[model samples]
Target: MAASSDAACPADPPAIDLRGLTKRFGRTTAVEDLSLTVGRGEVFGFLGPNGAGKSTTIRILLGLVRASAGSATLFGDDVRDVRRAHRHVAYVPADVSLWPSLTGAEILRLLERTGSAVDHEYRGLLVERFALDLDRAAKTYSTGNRQKVALIAAFATRAPLLILDEPTSGLDPLMDREFRRCVIEARDRGQTVFLSSHLLDEVEALCDRVAILRSGRLVEVARIAELRRLRRTEVEVSFTGQPPDLTRTPGVLETQDLGDSRLRFTLSGAAAPALRTLASSEIQTIEVRVPTLEEIFLEYYGGQDR
Candidate 1:
């Protein structure tokens, strides 16, 4: 008998379904009243700073920790039904650990046999692409190399859902590119990906939507476009003299004097108001651009340590 099956089951229910889920360790609440759903074939981003309950939510989904209240299910099967629920999932954590005595190849084969069905052809290609030395012992691998091993194994599996939490922690720029490519391929293959990362740019590029958590509670769930739309426009105007007094402008949030008769400020909502105000000034040149993802993320975190 085969150790695992690659056969995909019917996906009528969502890939992940959490309803009013909460977890508390005594008086400390790790995740509170969290309700979220990830559809089949959707790439969803899970974002939060440290101590935001992201890890606890993941643990509940994996059946590693039972939720104190509410429910979490995968394809309609309760996560508590570990064996059956696990059949549809593959997960890679930020820090990977393997048997020190086993060779890289052995570990790969072991994970395939124990976790999910193997995609042998894809596995071969990933091994080559990641440039992993399968003959070497796990104990000899560095942090980046260990991450590569786990990523290769996870990407080469036939699981219908993937849960990746900070999976690219120690990878270099070149390997980071490889990881992004694999994520795209996984989406093309109709896999539902739950990506948890501090890399806002990566999330912005790969995920269709994201759920943001803060202080053990769900703050928001929005599409990437919607999040970008919420950002204010950054307008930098160069004048013929001292900057104008647009601080009282309806849409301008803050202003900075860029010297050389230039002013930079953030404008939110409709630009018509700011534009009208700028038209009255002796503007020599004007530059308007949307804020970057990092800037937006900081806004969500209030520029605090995350």
Candidate 2:
């Protein structure tokens, strides 16, 4: 994925900016000293495990909750001034709940009226694309359908900024694809997207940059490629004879004896030194496993010292 064309520089005010944002509830701190920026027209991912402060940060940005300290801004306007900043924003929560007596179409119209502008043509297109049945009452719709309704409304508003909190939670695989497409289309139209998700694959596929949080603290923020570079590959080797001793090999982080002439080790950085070490043994079979996004995420939690 390429970086956003309008990525905010040092001198540029970001589409969304949070500086030392903190939130507390009595004795518990939900967020702490967190800060980041989402550029104009960027699909930025706020990623973390459950209760990792993703929702708290988003709520502050949306002005649904006031931060205990620090500041948040939308399009250069302080989010504390809710009305003005919210005029350019649209939000879709993770768990969507609509008025039970209203039909999907009615709900859509109501949401549209709240926004500054609505694209009727785009609304119609989204309804069709999501395969939503607008005639049905809201209470009769499934969780996925309710999500579709919210998505359609958000996309149709033509808002300059979209805040989607796990927007694909109840969507099937097919609808998930359509949702991603809509996000990309929004980006193409110069809209900024702040996507909060625990789904690593979704973030990897869509985001220009990702900020990872752990224990209510920001852990890392980098492009996907840069994050991937931090991962180490696992290599398993089986030999006809004795396995080569690789304890001192460069780039080899750890080694394990799998017994019966088999060995397992993790290789970081370049594979050249590891490969040469493996070649010294009578290799019968070898397997190299690339780390998955989940594994990389766990690594951060498991070894914070990294």
Error of 2 at 185 (Å): 1.9
**What's model 1's overall lDDT?**
0.91
Question: Candidate 1: where is the Cα deviation over 4 Å?
Answer: 1-11, 239-250, 255-261, 272-285, 303-306
* Clash count list over all predictions: 0, 0
Tens-place lDDT per residue, model 2, 72-132, is: 9998999999999989799999999999999999999899888858889988999999999
Candidate that scores best on TM-score? 1
What is candidate 2's CA lDDT for residue 24? 98
